[model samples]
Target: MRRVLALAACASATVYFEETFDSGIGERWQTSEWKDPMGAWVWTSGEWYTNEAKAKGMQASEDMRFHAISAKLDAPASTVDKELVVQFTVKHEKKDYAFCGGGYIKLLPGEVDPKAFGGDTPYAIMFGPDLCGYDISRIHVIFENKGENLLKSDEIKLDYSDKDEFTHLYTLHLKPDGSYEVFFDQKSKASGKLEDDWAFPSKEIKDPAISKPSDWVDTKRIPDPAAVKPEGYDDIPAEIPDPEAEQPEDWDAEEDGEWEPPMIDNPDYKGEWKAPMIDNPDYKGEWVHPMIPNADYAPDTYAKYPDLTTLGFELWTVNAGSIFDNILVTDDKAYADKMAADTWAIIKEGEKEAKDAWKKANKDDDDDDDADVDDDEEEEEEEELKDEL
Candidate 1:
């Protein structure tokens, strides 16, 4: 592909973080002993449907538990006038996966005690998909500012991938131009100016001096004074007996009693009537508040994060079995693309096939189980019949 070619062309871009979880989990990663302890992470391919050994990923091993882990980079990378790209893959493989948790990874600022990292620890950016029921299924892009975290204003809905339980890719590209692009499974999901999308303080505010005039009539329409309800409008009933009704010939007065015809919708009926509406003569158009330069808003280099020393995941999940793998934090988009193609794209089809095969195997087993149960029931019935005889 052209992306692979581009990657070869620009082979000089720096790679800040890369983890496949092949090994060195203890050597490279730090599991937090933060106040509530931490959930265990097992290197696994999940219970069903996998690409064999290739499917091995970092899986959250416990349900209803907190997980906090981080790995230190050999050299911390900074995003000063440089492009920063972060990408990772997640597989929610649990059959009954009901997520009330976070899978978003954090890019920790500078060097700090990795074990002490918790919910309170400051992070440069938190990015990934977070799902809780149907209402909240979105890839959160939150950034920290002055010890306070600011969540993105724009909602980046889920990619709505066909295979919800299969492994999917999430890629975030933060460029130097104050813009960002988020990709789901190599497909562009959301792209925009970071300033416009994130909860940054507005550059301008409503003019404090100006207020709406008291005489301004905002009501665009009003009931017409001349229009009136019909004199007998309220007197009409909604339904009446059919006028053409005749008693059935089979009906006997003593046996069937008096039979009445079913009521039909009344054609002459008129419901509660209101005066007709007309455009108000004194109506004024909707007023927009004039904006003035905000005195409080002072622009800064918000895009730059000088110290991105550690890559971490601090999460809490009700149903475990979310596998994370193929993480890459690099400056080169081309390289990241190539890496994704090499890892996710190639193995995805095989994974689906494997999943189907697993499902078929399980179904066959269930059928066998049902057959056994039927046989046992049949024997019991035969024994009962013999005793009766």
Candidate 2:
């Protein structure tokens, strides 16, 4: 019989890993650390081995390379409404690589299949430092909730440049819906919507008690952890919900004078822009973004027509040189045209009505003025007469 552990509702699920069974290095934990340090990313690889027989799980291997720990957790498939927080510490000896160590949580169906490792359909959360400087190897979250099945990728950069003694906290808040809200430390960084139709299994149970992979080895029948109330954890009250959760208020022109493109909502243009392709013969490399006086049109504004420089211009991806006159530049004219016309279209429509209203109000004020007895008007009329003289 397999021993099971039940998770409390709307609370932190704490499981202790005994150091005697498998330690961090001895467990051979897998991560993105196997590739060339210079290449894109390396996947760290290892397995968990336990000494206890009854306390063991269904998925244990003997590739010893970790610190001793007994209980290793497999995240529940659909823990929506549950904030899954993982706190751990990493010690680095070298500060040269800066982005030397990084890891990602594989929130998917099975052990990452090489065939689906970098495929467009996988789910993951990444954390680490970048090689380049300025103290920034923060955590980044990636998913494929939208876009081409292959290009389903997104990132959230964190600030973890100081590799000194630090306790890292990664929180995955499962929304009421199947989507997710990821936070580094306590700061919420990114939120993504999960498609309603995507097939997400509720649980994956691997019984460490069974050894033989025979036809009778039931992979589907994972015994649920018996219902036991969690102890030692503070039943803390929930914080008040933030209505504008991830929105940056200062990005608005009326609120903040600084330039921030991704924070703009309901922009003037509503057309999708694409990068320059071979389809257009006049495809010169003229997708440069122009400078703006107001800088309000800095991000998300397209470049000149056919110069769709803003093709991949996401809020998180726009840069300094890319923002032209408060507009994001593109490499294609069609994209630029759509952005310029759409944005100005809103202002133009409003301006026409505002101008007409202003003219009508001025005429009414002039007609209703106390023309025969107003000293202020008489003084203005005398001044006009003096100027004429």
Candidate 3:
């Protein structure tokens, strides 16, 4: 929590879009009916209290429905040769229901109707935290190219450290060098060249005119041909009758069945012998497909979006009440970092105290029971507020 207001004077960065949702949110943002019946989006501090009104965010106010909302940027953001940074914060207030939901946002390119933005709307990039069931937890970093949304081949796994109800930041930094980095709560989580983790076109491809030799021996090991099994090894039985069994003196032979010894594993029984494995003398190394210069190979220019005009969220959450705030899209990493410090870092401690106070005020008198509202009841209370459009 640097709480750094010192870096506010820097003007080298270009901020295409920024919002704290402190006030005037609905005037700049719009909702979509992409799902016909969509979840409600509210601007509040949720059930908990916050000392700073800026901490109040865009919350998915309902449960078990889709939510799509977007806002036009002050100007179109272009990633021609400069670094692009997308950062936002989220809080999953429902502890038990945080497992199945999404808190990610997207950057749209070209003309987009903010009111009509939905899952089908084309976007340049998407970045944020997402959890579905116990197995799927990750900070999604997806980019759209050639009409397909490309996901990282190697996933970004999320764990207990990143999953919490407290406010936390998610950031994605994409550079012009085909490199990118992902951060969680201001700490680096993953970084690599885009092509290494994405489905970018390769510079070369396997030659279609050539193949590995048919006689190539790829086996690394083989059984020893000279090894022989010992004579009469199969004579030993796997099991034998118990040698210590004895009949009780009071047992009645006429009324009861004859006593039988329990079978046991034979101590001296030898198992079937196997030849020792050795390195294959004639084996060639594993065949690698011959590669050639592919005519289809091209530099990944799709990474750059020249006309990105909107920033928004379009996701489905089984459990709502996740808050999103401090949305930022900038051309400088230093600027975004400073903004984060001045906002989330400074207000986090006070927010925590306020949240605790609110919880205490709402605690049950019995003490043994939790006062939190039941999620199922809330789900039933939530219904689509149909759009007039």
TM-score per candidate, in order?
Answer: 0.75, 0.29, 0.81
Candidate-wise lDDT, in order:
0.77, 0.29, 0.79
Which candidate, 1 or 2, would have the higher lDDT against the true structure?
1
Candidate 3: worst-modelled 10 consecutive residues by lDDT: 380-389
Alpha-carbon shift of residue 157 in model 1 (angstroms)? 2.1
Prediction 3 global C-alpha lDDT = 0.79
State each candidate's clash count: 0, 68, 0
> Model 2, 3-84: lDDT tens per residue?
1122322122322111111212233222222222212111111111111221111111111121111112232332333223
lDDT at position 209, candidate 3: 93
Judge candidate 1 at residue 330 and give its lDDT.
83
lDDT of 1 by residue, 110-130 (tens): 766878888788899999988
Candidate 1 regions with alpha-carbon error over 4 angstroms = 1-9, 35-37, 48-53, 95-101, 133-135, 159-163, 223-278, 296-300, 358-389
The residue pairs in collision within model 3 are none
TM-score of 2: 0.29
RMSD of each: 9.2, 37.3, 7.4
| Candidate 3 local lDDT, 1-389, one digit each (tens) | 11212235466777878888877466778988777788888878778756557578888878888898898887777777778889988888774422588889999998888767888888989889887644567888998888889998888887644555778888899898889999988889999888778887787889999888999999999999988887887888999998987778877878877877789999998676788899999999899999998675555584788888988999888887888888888878888888789777865666567777877787778852434445344333331211210
